[model samples]
Target: MTAALRATGVALEAASLIALRQVALRSRAEPVLAALPGGFATRRKGHGHEVADVREYVSGDDIRHLDKGTTARTGALHVRQFHEERDRVTLLVADFRSSMLWGISRAFRSVAAAEALALIGWQGVSEGGRVGLLALTPDGQVAVSPRGRVRGVLDVIGGLVRAHEQALQSVMAGTVADRSLDMAMSGLERLAPLGSEVIIASGFDDMGQGMEQRLAELARRRVPRLIRITDAAAGKLPKGRYPIRLSDGRRLRVSLSGHAQTQHETETICGRAALLIDAGSGVEQTARLLAANLPADRAP
Candidate 1:
């Protein structure tokens, strides 16, 4: 069995998350929080106190906002326009599939994913936004609705820990598979609110067909950030033939001496990711990379 499958202990705890928050607060001007679109202001109009403009009433305009004095003086129907400052929703999608259970670094890919999730979650909540979770595991999937303030952040961290434990159990039993990622993506579409910012933390080893289309559809309405987590071993394989065993008790032999495996893994995982975080990298490095890559306009 892989070391990751047999690993014990919680990869992340509430204390770790709290520490991260303290660090983030100290470096508030570093743009780390701005990496996530969750902190950015949205353009969706709503009934707010701040008047944006005053214009002639249109057929579809809300009648309740009609300006009676303007209509009477100009003999034309007018409506008051207002702009609302809405909080952005940040959804953390953690992939706990069998593939994520393998790592040759300081921790498992799943563990790295959980750490990244925590950092992003804290950043979103600190920026006055809501945080939610979508954990996809071999045993099953778990969804936590977005909550505001500290409660929401804690809920997401709790969900990550639970999903990791369940995934570990599945790995130990050798019942892990790779069919839940597609389903999780589907769930993301249904559960995500309009204009929400989504962070997908995974290795993308089992990215199924039609994933690009689904992501395209999601990007149309929401900001989708791909935090691709991979181990160093995945990029380079020693020249030799290796025996591989399937989760279903099947055994097969494959040659890793050639570049085929490396190329395939790169195309499958790295090619599609917007941001790549190595499993061996530190959590602070991941946060800095994400912040640096964010658009200048999005920076807080």
Candidate 2:
């Protein structure tokens, strides 16, 4: 049992590292960290790599320092231009209420879901993108989105883990998973035309496909992605008909002998459901399947 637990930890850590590496590469901040911004590459007047012809300086021009050659040619002092792009925002939603607290593995569904959110948020912050938590449950509060400093990334992950522990200690699942199911989708709907990237991280064990259908509508407007985190237990029941004993000592036999069929059904549901959110696919064995479906540009 101890060995099995250790193996699980190793797998989880490996999964997080894989996601972190991917985010680092996609951000492309390695070599440039040492050099000041706009210093490594020579600035071109136009989009080219070298000096193109220059024209009269405009109000929007940088005009910090103009190219002498361009000034000598047309006699207009214009600042050099460089390549640039606007940063994109990635909204992440985490559900931590009743439904996610139950699972079939060493970790419950909530733990895996929180793990996915942590990695994805780390990626968004590392890439200098805006990250926000749209909704949360049990606690009935949102972080209001603090700036994604490196320390802030670590803090958010730590806080999420701590929050889970507190929930367990305090027994805060008094509310049902369906407490705000429709309302949650309503919040998602308001974020239409996400323009940037939208990521919804949840066990997705809520009530029905109403929120999912709304998510499908939202997907049409922007770069949409879904990171689904599920463990083997949540995917299917364990094999054999063992007595399911209750806390009150009541026992019932469950007929899960057809393990293969059950597993197939669970996988099918997860896959087809993901299609509704424009997600390519997902992972059922562990929380690491996020590497494949993350934003390509944000990959290592």
Instruction: List the candidate 2 regions with Cα displacement exceeding 4 Å.
Output: 1-86, 151-155, 169-180, 185-193, 220-223, 233-238, 242-253, 261-288, 296-300
TM per candidate? 0.71, 0.55
- What's the distance in Å from true for residue 27, model 1? 5.2
User: Can you write out model 1's per-residue Cα lDDT over 190-291, one digit (the tens) per residue?
Assistant: 778988888898987767776787777887888787877877665576778888876556889987764533321122332343566777777677666654
Quality of model 1 by C-alpha lDDT: 0.71
* Cα lDDT for residue 16, candidate 1: 65
Question: Which TM-score value belongs to model 2?
Answer: 0.55
Q: Please tell me which predicted candidate would have the highest lDDT against the true structure.
A: 1
Enumerate residue pairs that collide in model 1: none
Q: Any idea how many clashes model 1 has? A: 0
